[model samples]
Target: MSRGPKKRTLEVEEIISLYKKGESTTRIAELANVSSRYINKLLLKHNVERRPRGHWKRKYHFNEDYFKTWSGTMAYILGLFTADGFISQQGQTVSIAQKEKDILEEIKRELKTTQPLYRNKSTGVYMLYMHSKKMKDDLMNLHGLNPCKSNNVEFPYVPQEYLHHFVRGYFDGDGSINFKGYTIVFVGGSYLFMDTLQRILNDKLNIDTNLVTDKTNYRLFLSGRKTIQVFAQWIYKDKNLFLERKYLEFMKEKTPLDLLEDRKFRNTKNAVKLRKQKFLEQLTKTNCIEKASSLIGITTNTSKQWLENDSDLKEKVNILLNNNK
Candidate 1:
């Protein structure tokens, strides 16, 4: 015989109420003797959302105060990195003091114009103010940190010397070159200087050597290993003509009076005389001798006599000719 008509199922609202009141879907389904799928379908049909059991909702929200604090702290860290002598703009050197001063001024200017908005209800303005204070403290701590002092500190203006020491230190530390051997290191600022030194030392001094300059770094080496300072002084005193030309180029970028500040050039008659002659020769080569000598500080005729009498200059010319083949 056919069974009586099936009983109608309970409405979705009733199922949802039971579920909200902590009744399991399985228990509800059993009580109604309906499939669990039907219970789930009914709940969805009524637009009831079911969250996973035992999951906790997030208790915190990010506010403007938190963002400002974090941003300010990050800014301070960036400022510190700059102040601590980061290489920038194709390795052009900048001092820590200069970077620090610039950042401090910028921060002060920003603070003057910036206005805070949307404070945290629980933390209030204290969180924001504390962040600012923390930034200041961090900057102060960075300022107190001493800069890494190098042996070439006495000659800050001489970039060649700075580069030389750096290279030497790097090589010595890395065991790339032995300092104790019968080794000659050609040091200079530009490739021209270093190249010239390499040739001159090879020809004149007959020394076995390596040319340590910036070019090597670009092609094969790493940073913080250039020692142009010791190399420059060595070349000047030892009368390395290749290095002398490099020094001349370096000096040409500066005034004669400024060049005189270098003890290697200033203390020696030969260095001073060689520099003056090289200056005139460079001017003559560039067709600027007439205009250059017209300046109040320069004496072209005296420079000529110095060049004529320079033994080192004569030797360099002879060496160049010999190596020309």
Candidate 2:
């Protein structure tokens, strides 16, 4: 006599646990190695009220094809995921933990999923979880992200056209702007990752910054008002998505005229620095700091600052002056 395959046995607790954890019924069935009907029966036995049919399909719905190509939104989300997102051992479960629920809500809207946000009361962190095998595979194979990628994560190749959008996304996740210091910073665990960012920003974009270690992690710092403003313009270029908290804070400090003037007068930072040196050197010929500053079309105080920054130039000026005396 041919015996039928043994029926897969499932416990009520197992089904309930998956359900409470936001697993869809179909996914729960797959996890439990049973039919969806059996899972539903067990849920009913435990007095778990059934949601309307197809609720999970609707709630968990998202454009799984989102990561297939390099678009602005896709690039931004990928960058955000690189910084703050986590993939499970199975590579099917993905999550983002943020201190602000508002950003999570915005990401939720963007992913087009209704997955509920969970909070860790102890840490005051809000978590958004998403489950999709295809999405995970795209991130791993098409992109270079993998499970447990924190310290070893490498900078994924991004098209030059979409790079700024990707950077904005990463910045929203692992970066910050300090209005008080007129500073912008990005923090990551991998030295290579920080180095790559510095290379791109410094060499490609003409935005300069220094890289340093911030305790266990590494960081890149861009300080001073004009630099951060220029970076903000570059990162926020497309006028699309962002972590609104950071964006709104930046707007409060920004205005059109400020940027225009920064570009108009400064021209190139190196040029400005050299021009300052040129005028300061002219102090010997003018025999007066005020006259030299006037020739440079700048305030005398500003010329003094230029001298203060260059010890060699200052020493040369002092020697010429003492010789004249």
Candidate 3:
């Protein structure tokens, strides 16, 4: 017989503990004087499966989700572009000329095919086209769609001309507005004009501009046929307005208005009040009323009014405040 049955070579428990603590199989193998394959086998024997790593979660994930709730369709379109590799989240800048060219090419390719454009079953409206087989495959893979389903079959032709017409009309229509340098193209109908515009500016432009659309009422001032003209002029005068105050003087001369009398400008004042109220509420909830008030640059009286007007909010504030005290 062998010497004590070869010491029984036991390490299953040690291997499992290391695996649970996220140690790599190779490292565990090295430490345990076993092959990586054996370490993997030990992991399998213990019924442990390694999880694939994912991209880092962003701080703005919550804010982005909230914004999406307010602008679901617009968010969907943006997500489509992102899925199609037209946009990047890494803060790398692409030239406007290059983006326009790439988008045009994508439009051309998309028009060549017959794809089932998604229709909003609830509203009886056609959503956008899926365009390519690759896109369809991606959707199938990511969303796990059944390929046999026939509800949203791909169309055979793209109707490129119709698409072009729609694009031109959509931008030229009543919902369009111009921002500092670029034209703010709004999609959807009249009821969604302001909301759509705000979402576009906030989500797309804010990445580069450092300007938050929700904080300003620029959309209100942007309307009618003159909106395009103002937008184009702004673009012509300062292509880099978002990065610098390059065209402020020029824009002021071209579109001078009484800030006090302008309804749009006045809306900004209301926004400020709302923002302060929210800041105070958050501060009180966190029990850092004095610190948050100072950090928010708001007066105590304003914070007090917000607390008094909303009794429910006041109760939350008191809890936070007392807990800290």
The candidate that achieves the highest lDDT relative to the unseen native structure:
2
Q: How far is candidate 3 from the true structure (C-alpha RMSD, Å)?
A: 20.4
Index of the highest-TM-score prediction: 2
The reply for model 3, stretches above 4 Å from the true place, is 1-80, 83-116, 123-125, 129-275, 278-325
At residue 35, what lDDT does model 1 achieve? 67
Error of 2 at 139 (Å): 0.8
Worst 10 residues of 1 by lDDT: 218-227
Cα lDDT tens digits for candidate 2, 163-193: 9999998998999876654667788998878
Per-residue lDDT of 56 in model 3: 23
Expressed as tens digits, the lDDT of each residue in 64-174 for candidate 1 is 122123232333333222222222221111222221133334333434423122122332311111113233333334332112322111211113323333332222222
- Taking all chains together, the TM-score of candidate 2 against the true structure is 0.63
Question: What's the lDDT for residue 223 in model 1?
Answer: 12
Which lDDT values do the candidates have, in the order given? Answer: 0.35, 0.74, 0.36
Order of models, best lDDT first:
2, 3, 1
Model 2 misplaced stretches (Cα beyond 4 Å): 1-18, 24-59, 254-325
- Cα TM-score of candidate 3: 0.20
Higher-scoring candidate on lDDT, 1 or 3? 3
Rank by TM-score, highest first: 2, 3, 1
Q: Mark the 10 consecutive residues where model 3 has the least summed lDDT.
A: 87-96
In the order shown, what is each candidate's alpha-carbon RMSD? Answer: 27.1, 15.4, 20.4
Question: Residue 299: error of model 3 in Å?
Answer: 16
* Per-residue C-alpha lDDT of model 3 across residues 68-160, encoded as one tens digit per residue: 221222222222232222111122111111112333233323234232232223334332222133444433443332233222222111132
